[model samples]
Target: MQMHQTARNDLLLDVRNLETHFFGEDSVTRALGGISFQVKKGETLGVVGESGCGKSVTALSILRLLPKVSARTVGGEVRFHGRDLLDLSDREMRKIRGDQIAMIFQEPMTSLNPVYTVGRQIAEAVQIHTKASRSAAMKKAEEMLRLVRIADPERRVNNYPHEMSGGMRQRAMIAMALACSPELLIADEPTTALDVTIQAQILRLIVDLKERTGTAVMFITHDLGVVAETCQRVIVMYAGRIVEQANVIDLFARPAHPYTQGLMRSVPDRRRGRQRRLPEIPGIVPSLREPIVGCSFAPRCPFAIDICREKRPPFLDVGSSHAAACWRAEEVMGA
Candidate 1:
């Protein structure tokens, strides 16, 4: 198979050959192994993978938040607005963080400071990024709470994170993330801990806010259902590398990569039949203690060939802006 270039479009954030490694006592684990993707202005790039697939690491690398003393970005470049984030000084990176880019973490309980009231937490972000006075910031925090569809914003703002329910805490986190009007928002499983009804509400709130603010979002989740509802484009990661990427509709309609196919097949479809059992991918995800020598998914891939055991496959364009990294690309396409 030959490499094909997809149509070039304006990109808001571009990550190229990103490699984040964590040094342990006996071995160095490669958390992210040369992963690359881009997010366009007013677009949501949904990154989906099983747990421990380097999804969260990619997010932290972009923000330069990984502990540099032990965790190192040994290679690659992360460019935001044409500036290389890896080259930026700590002070410079701090300015970009929360101002140009913001993150809504998975668990609001752990992400939020327990001692601070929700209003004060949001206000701190506002005051740090914008030249808002304490009173003004507090007022804006209340407005932000209202914008996120939280009822009784004035009362909620004064409550600490532990005082609110799970759904309310998630909303407060969203309010705080959007306090500075960031151009890019990285939502790392923001709805994971919420109930079904609240999850849908939060997803809709994110969509509405993005439409209003024109903020580019990197939404990371293990749920394909969430991707279907929230994303425009989807990137499927496996064992630290992107295995498949396509528009949301195309990805669901025709997943070219075997791993992606397995993921789609695994989603429970109760409408199919009462006897339908969810398909599961067998075997465990490979440890990244050492450099991967071959196609990372080869061990679990149903169609893997001999060549797949010895060599890593380059990402090949399947069709219509879709790409997949697999040695048996032709087999996947039935060529």
Candidate 2:
């Protein structure tokens, strides 16, 4: 009763059947096909899939950052704190973007302004959202640099984006995103370009900062290892749609969807010891430019049946708090 109502109230971001499309000369790429999910307060929700699976698109669309001319959110509602973001004007969306919700984009090198100093850039975000004075925002920026564990923050704040190392720039991005203490932070492959050691450090820093700020994080990455390490729950997307949703343990233990199982098999298992080659998912991913007739993964799924190619499977609960969009979910899980 009371707890249930409280839980509902805790739903920070609710995306309902979000449909996004990119128009071209003669084709329409269905970038996001009515995908829906929820991000609760202070939880790290991972959205993962191979490239072109709409993970990044989902983040951009939720924040209304997609291009205006070609790309449009054709349908759906992105409700943040019970207010639909889709209905907000551009000015209103801008306010919400850095203040209430911040995002760390894929590439820090390009995402950060080359001409602006790191601290100035961070302070700009703070000033926009907090309306702080120049000196005060600069101070806040230095504090954020320290918060992200950047050494010599006082000196580093004056450094331009190009002057810093890849990982350092990424840390700066995180700092900027957190300067306002946003309620939800969307990170799109923030560690993809860093070295193994740097990647580990960034991941730890994000987890630490997220805990310290009590900010809900929507981590979008193709790395299952990162998801397993940082996220409590994850959504597996395929061809712009969610194929499975489960907690880290359940998903790794018992993958209910064939596509998910394939992805798991593709990951290197050190326990198995040297193999000739890693197992691969057969066939290429479907092109989103055309309408998919049935289950998008049917062509590549080994467990796919005739029905899989004939009809789209509903996203259904397979076990407690675990769901998959597969008709053969039980069989796949058991096997």
Candidate 3:
């Protein structure tokens, strides 16, 4: 998030005031509420928040992958390469997806076609995007599998989704996403399903692959540990909006938002005795179905003042390139 001598052209993706809602028979659920951020070219940007905080929804919204029947993005612009993605025709959008901006979904089993070999799926993407010959695309697929460090690319490419282990499947997913070498890679909880050891391996693999490919990444996860290991910049979302955005190091060292402080406190502290219960944020997340009168996190924030409960706070500058939507960021950071 550091903007030291940063130019506007350095941005690979620029999202402005994005808002997404899901409509039901009775009421509408506000999934994303005017959240905005940027991803610099070749930098790994992490979006971390608790479940239902619009982390996944942000990714989906950016890709235009949300369910059409229910979810709708009512406002805002998703700009990539100086073009507004929301205004693109479906055909144009299709061409851009997987070629210009690719996404690796959370669950490989659900995403990977059960009927097709892993190789075919990857080759299909290459073929569709690049229009390469079947043989050439298959060759590219094999090369991608090798790139992701999948053992025996020759044999593994022919294996079905079920045939590969969880880690392998996730790797294959990454390979498919990177097959065409997209400029922006959106990985939505890519390591959520894998075991701890496998999770570490996957995280390492993503970092290595991003460096090798020079691809910018939007990594969405609930784990701050993953963010610390992989991201240069971090966006902390709460109640459908970004509460704080800062460099990963600064975010950990001085969390200016009370919600961010609460989240950090919830992380297990090795220095603390085992008998000490993990700290938690005090109140339930505000319901998004109804209108939020003030700061959505004020109900749970320990530093809330009268104005925090009466009127929403604007994003205040905590430092260079660090901002938080909090009335008492100074007190929160010192606390």
Lowest summed-lDDT stretch of 10 residues in model 3? 1-10
Comparison by lDDT, 2 against 3, better one: 2
lDDT of the candidates, in the order given: 0.90, 0.94, 0.93
On residues 82-113, what C-alpha lDDT tens digit does candidate 2 reach at each position?
Answer: 88999999999999998999999878999999
List model 1 lDDT by residue over 105-153, tens digit each: 9899999999999999999999998899999999999999999988999
Error of 2 at 246 (Å): 0.2
Winner on TM-score (1 vs 3): 3
Q: Write one digit per residue (lDDT tens) for candidate 3, span 1-335.
A: 33422547687898999999999999999999998899999999999999899999999898899999999999999989878899999899999999999999889999999999999999999999986999999999999999999999999989999999999999999999999999999999999888999999999999998998899999999998999999999999998999999999999999999999999888887876676888888878888999999899988878988999999999989999999999999999999
What ranking emerges by lDDT with the best candidate at the front?
2, 3, 1
| Per-model TM values vs. the true structure | 0.95, 0.97, 0.97
- Give the residue spans of candidate 2 off by over 4 A: 1-7
- Candidate 3's TM-score reads 0.97
Residue pairs in clash, model 1: none
